[model samples]
Target: MSARTFLRIAVSNTLVKNIARYVMMMLLALLLFGIILLATGKDPFQSYRDMFGATFGSAYGFSEVLVAMIPMLITALAVALPSRVGLINVGGEGQLYIGAAFATWGALTFKDQPAWVLLPLMALLGMIGGALWAFIPGYLKSIGLVNETITTLLMNSIAPKIVGFLIFGFWHSPMDTVKTENFVSAARLPTFFNTRVHLGFVIALVLLALFWIIMKYTRWGLEMRAIGGNPQAARRNGIPLKGYLIVIMCLGGAIAGLAGMSHVSGFYGVLILNFSMGLGFMGFLICWLAGGDPIGIFLMSFVVAIITTGGNFLQLTQGLPYAVINILLALALFVVLASPKFFEGKKA
Candidate 1:
């Protein structure tokens, strides 16, 4: 056979296999979800209808879904970027909390400043906070051979405790709430068309586009991908592994910090304990589902947002437990990890 013909055949087979794998994963997840519903004496079809209707049936529902997608998109990029350099960054949760705290501090300290000044200042502080939190893990990994996953996860636990202490002690209001005072008007992110959908949504989209370009065309991105593919080869090529690891990890943390700031500035306008609501972890799943493709991350983040928004309807109307939504998400991750056979081409 000719070389060109063999190459074409190989590419076609690979494409077909990938398509089959994705379809199988989806089908398996749905099947498992249906089984759970049946075991609980509920109709899966009706539940699905309710879920979809609540998320997409009205403009308002769709708007809420978009609101939910903003932070997910940013935080997903946090995970995806570092993953390209063969690093697992699980500390987005901690980074996010610290980011929010720093942003809140800026807002409170500069309450009388103009929007142009205060907003940017808050964002910078948030990024710095997140990057610092991420840097510790990166530095330890580079210097002491510590596992980034464990350090980052441990940081996640520590960040909330710090926030709790601040809100419950120093920043606490006499109103008996564990949340800080509301941010000034100038500190709040602007909305689009006077809707609840804030500027953070647009920011997430811009970051997605920016990262896509960087990953596809930039030299740095190429180096990161090479390192991910083979560390020994990257080292042989004279790539500075330690420097790249720390830089990429810090960049990821900065993105997650932006997510935290967005949540406070655009959604809550106040710093509260546990305000993240597991969005950082959801971002991890988004990265896994997207396979580290920026565009795929954008699309999958929205899909997860739909599920989250729909889950609220499941609770309010159908009286279903919120755990059902968690089960659905877990099933999705399971199927993606378990269905590799569909991606395998026929052997000779």
Candidate 2:
């Protein structure tokens, strides 16, 4: 066979393999969901119908899903960026909490300030707070050979506690609630179309585009990819391994921090104890599902947002459990991880 013929055959085979893998993943998820429904004595098809209707049936539902996607997109980028440097950033949860805490503090401190002055300061402080939280693990890994995965995960637990302390102790409102005072009107994020969808959605999109450019075109991105692919080789090529690790981890934390800020300023308008609600872990899953691709992450974040939003609908309208959504996400991750053959075909 000619070289051209061989290339064509190889490409076709790879495409076939990817299609098979995706089909199998979907089938497995559906099967598992059906089994769960059977165990619960619920009609799987009816439950699915209600879920779809709730999330995508109305403009308000769709807008709420988009609102949820804003944070997921930013936080997923946090995980994706660090992954490119061969680092696992499980600290997004903690980073997000700390970021929001800082942003809230900034807002409360400068309550009399104008919107233009306070909002940017809140965002900057939030990023710094998240970066500092993430820096702890990065510093440990760089200096002491500590596992970042463990450190980052531990930080997640610590972060909410710190936020709780602030709300329950220092920043607690006089109304006897476990939440801080609402942000000043000037500090709240502006919305569009009189919907819950805020400027944060636009920011997430712009960041996604910027990240795509950095990952595809920049020398730093090339170096990060090289490091992720082969740390020893990257070091041999003089990629400044320690510095890159620290910087990338910080960058990831900063993005997550921005998510926390956006959540507070745009959605809640206040810092609360459970503001994060496992978004960091969800972001990690989104990164895995997207295989750390920026565009893939952006799309998958919306998919996840739909699942979560629809799952809530299922619970309220169909009497199905919300945990079903988590099961589906886990199944999808399991299928992807187990299908090494799918990835191998792509390499061919």
RMSD of each candidate? Answer: 4.9, 4.5
1-348, model 2: which lDDT tens digit per residue?
589986896689765766676767767876887788778898888887887787788888899889989999999888888888778898899999999999999989999999999989999998999999999899888775799999999989999999999899899889966898888899899988877999899989998899888977899978888888888899999989999989888888999999999999999998988778899898987777777766567767876787777788878876656776788667766776676543341110
lDDT of 1 by residue, 160-205 (tens): 9999998888886668568888888999999876568999998888
lDDT of each: 0.84, 0.84
lDDT of 1: 0.84
Q: Which whole-number lDDT from 0 to 100 does residue 95 have in model 1?
A: 92
Q: Candidate 2: where are CA atoms >4 Å away? A: 1-24, 340-348
Q: Candidate 1: where are CA atoms >4 Å away?
A: 1-24, 340-348
Question: Could you give me the TM-score of model 1 versus the true structure?
Answer: 0.88
Error of 2 at 11 (Å): 14
